[model samples]
Target: METEPSAALMSAIVTEHFVLQSGAGTTVSEALGRSSLYLSALSSSLIALGFAAQTPGLLLPFAAAALPTVFVLGVFTMVRLVGTGVQNMLYLSGISRIRGYYRTLDPEAARYFARWGAGDGETDDALGSLAVRGGPMAGLFTAASMIAVINGVLAGVGLALLTYYVVTDHHLPAALAVGLVAMTAGLAMFFRYQHRCYLRVQR
Candidate 1:
């Protein structure tokens, strides 16, 4: 014979559901905070670079020192944000499972949480509504993608400045070409990492 869930079991399930939801929200907030910190640092660096540019003999040295630092910071931020995204997805999945259990306890509970249930289709649709469309291109629209692109540009520009000032004899054309190549390579590397992260999430 079928029996109702014990009160203690129900209380535990409710607590787990609340914890998972809180975790998901915390991950999102953390991602935003980390991104903001990275951007604030980048902006301050750019402003300092602007000031350095006005002073003779300071621009090259300051840029040479600052650009690499900013790029490294960006790399760290991007990686952490990707991890946060993964954590949030896991939390959401747990919450969805709990909602499914709730529906099992009361058939009418499905109406209130119509989007999420034991059915994979309903869960996927609910998640899709919350995030971008899934595919190879989905990662490109994330905050991590934005940081990766900016870091790539910084790397390229840093290389170009070094080439023009130290390696080449101030050859603008050669430096430009080198910078473009570096930027392309950096972007490719970052995108590859993001793709791998996306694949993990898919699994």
Candidate 2:
């Protein structure tokens, strides 16, 4: 006859997995949030400086450099956010896999997460009965919220400034073309990454 694992051993394993998964999820969530906030603040500050730089005379000389600096910072910040989001997806991937194990151990765990959510409803009602299942990410996270919209605005401003700077400094229309191409490529890659992440959860 085949022998099954003892209840005590299974309990210990489940408890340990729960603790580890919880801690990992919290750490990733906090890091991702903080990173996003920092990037947003930095982008806003740069945009502010860009405006200040437009002032005639006085600090204009120093401020003239701010555009390039701000543009570069925004680019780097976007890259970092994209990378951190991938990290978030990885964390989610691992945590969800563990959740699968737990659900198998105790089928009751499955009900804790909602599979579908109502699009229009009172906040309380949605959260209580029909809110999206996953936190922050919400499985794919493809839908744009207010924050995502703001981030896109910031990125748009940065790209516009950067392309303008390239044209002005280099006097080359080709450089502007390149920047546009790069932005499009980056966006395509981002969507691909998100799509793959969403697919992982499906399985």
> Highest lDDT, which number?
1
- Residue-level error in angstroms, candidate 1, position 12: 1.2
lDDT of 1 by residue, 1-203 (tens): 66899999999999998998899889989989999998899899999999999999999888988888888999899899888877777787777777767777776887876653233643364356466556678778877888888888888888998898899989999899999999999889888888887677657
Worst 10 residues of 2 by lDDT: 121-130
Query: Could you report the Cα RMSD, in angstroms, for every candidate shown?
Result: 2.4, 7.8
List the candidates' TM-scores in order.
0.89, 0.49
Residue 55, candidate 2: C-alpha displacement in angstroms: 2.6
Count of steric clashes across candidates, in order: 0, 0
Highest TM-score, which number? Answer: 1
